[model samples]
Target: MAHTIREKNKLLARVKRIKGQLDAVERALEAEAECEKVMHLLVSARAAMTGLTAEVVEDHVRTHLVDTELFPDALREDGVEELLAVIRTYMK
Candidate 1:
């Protein structure tokens, strides 16, 4: 939630691009464009959505679950960084 405010514009821009893709898909259907073209639009929109999902999840992890100032070696040296790395790999 905290990161959302700081990254609001970037997130909104992504949403706008996604809206544009949806509009394109609707128009393509209305015009009865080739299936290939419509499918491309759908694919693009899906990929954009996936990227947005990953980014928000990453921000949530960093904002809510991570503590920057301390890492107990018993917990794993640099545990926060290690957790973040695992999250990044898993999200992808």
Candidate 2:
């Protein structure tokens, strides 16, 4: 997907923050922190990962799922089917 420089920077920043969170989770594991603390960190990390995945999926859909212009009405059904197929695969 084509992203403005600003958008790219924002995504990069998010990825970096997720990386840091992952590192913290690792440290918590190594330090034998409380089980609840480690579990909380893991849950947060998973949430971040899910958000990142969603962002990428949205970008992909915007870029490739449906044409905004010159989209043939006759092909709309096919387009919807293709989009649903992709979304199903991605969700899996």
TM-scores for every predicted model: 0.73, 0.66
- The lDDT for every candidate, in the order shown, is 0.80, 0.74
lDDT of 1: 0.80
| Candidate 1 residue lDDT tens string, 40-60 | 999989989888987887677
Q: Candidate 2: which pairs clash?
A: none
Off by over 4 Å in 2: 4-6, 66-92
Model 2 lDDT on a 0 to 1 scale: 0.74
lDDT of 2 by residue, 41-77 (tens): 9899888887777667656655555554656343465
Candidate 1 global Cα RMSD: 3.8
Which candidate number maximizes TM-score?
1
After the best TM-score superposition of candidate 2, give how far the Cα of residue 89 lies from its true spot, in angstroms.
16
Q: How high is the lDDT of residue 74 in model 2?
A: 34
Clash totals, every prediction? 0, 0
